[model samples]
Target: MPAPHILSVFDQDMDRLQAQILSMGGLVEEAIRDAALALETRDDELAARVVEGDKKIDALEEDINTAVVRVLALRSPAAGDLRTVITVMKVAGDLERLGDYAKNLGKRVPILAQAHRVEGAAASIKRLAKSVRLMLKDALDGYARKDLDLVRDVLQRDVEVDQMTNALFREFLTHMMEDPRSITSCMHLLFISKNLERMGDHVTEICEQIIYLETGTRPEARPKGTSTAQVDVPYPGSRT
Candidate 1:
């Protein structure tokens, strides 16, 4: 057992690390929201802001990584304490990827704004993004509260996100086939939908880490929605 003073310092370090992870999660959630709004309204300036905000999110991840290294090196945290430290690092990485996906969504806004708008595509993308954002929020809350039920909720919600993405994929395909001119816009929306779906995936990963942290055991196989592959549309930029 660590001495009383040493344990106090370790707890303080853990608190600081957890705080940084939550801050990063907050930035990521905002990025997802802003990117979705920019897409729906075709607001170029707001999209630019989402892209710019990614830098801060990236920096926070770096800070979290450094702090995690310091904790591992200096404290040599064991058992549950070590699990908590590792979970913080894993969550930070997932949050960074979420921010990157949001930035990608923002990057498409300018192109999407100029292209012929696919009917109802922007609204659909917004809905998808909103679902992902909520999942991320819940995942972070579960981690903070150490709530297993909340973690399970996030895992279950990911199936809904996949279903949403699949439906959007079909909708976009129909638009592209009917109006060839809309292909360009539909393609970009496809990318955006894929981004939001991937964000759900990352959020799910965070919840899994939370489960592992709390239980020292990984959760069961994740529930999955309909496979997008059934639709037979090649994902944009996918390798043959």
Candidate 2:
């Protein structure tokens, strides 16, 4: 262990980085929840708020990037210190992507609200969104606490999100086939489900960074339940 005085400043820098990541994660989680709720409730105002909130997340990501860069330049950090800075930057990027997906979902709410609601679509979407949000919370908490077990749990949750997306895909397909009138609503629902699944993927990416930060090597073969070919949803159910 280094002397108390020298260690204090280093600890402060690390703590600040971790705190910023958690702050960003919180905004992202809120965005996901609000976006899903807006879709479910058809609240255009709430959806608009989610869109506007994306800017704050983007600004926070920029702040994190700047701070990480400055730390790298100012301090010739040891191997562990270097890993923390790099991992924070990676986690920030993942969180920013999650915000973008939420923003995309929010922006589509008005279009979806105008269409006829498909039976059971909103409930399924909410379930998917809730799972992704929980995984995100776990990933953020694990990183902040440096808890590898929590990170492992987050990694496993991504598989469930993918499975949910695949099931949603099949359901929407059946709906569209049964009622051509339901195409518009089913299409939007498919996109929302895909967005939520992608959010879970971003959470898993953050988990990977946390794992790497704690242990020098990356985790072996991250869990995945859906393949690109199977999930390549074109026009909400096109087999092509």
Give me the candidate number with maximum lDDT: 1
Error of 2 at 99 (Å): 0.3
lDDT of 2 by residue, 116-208 (tens): 779888888999999999999888888767789989988987898889889999889778878898998888888888788878878888888
| Candidate 2 vs. true structure, TM-score | 0.92
Worst 10 residues of 1 by lDDT: 231-240
Judge candidate 1 at residue 57 and give its lDDT. Answer: 97
Residue 121, candidate 1: alpha-carbon lDDT: 84
Q: After superposition, how far is residue 58 of candidate 1 from its true place, in Å?
A: 0.4
Report lDDT per candidate. 0.90, 0.87
What is the Cα-based lDDT of residue 135 in candidate 2? 92
Using all chains and alpha carbons, the TM-scores for the candidates as numbered come to: 0.95, 0.92
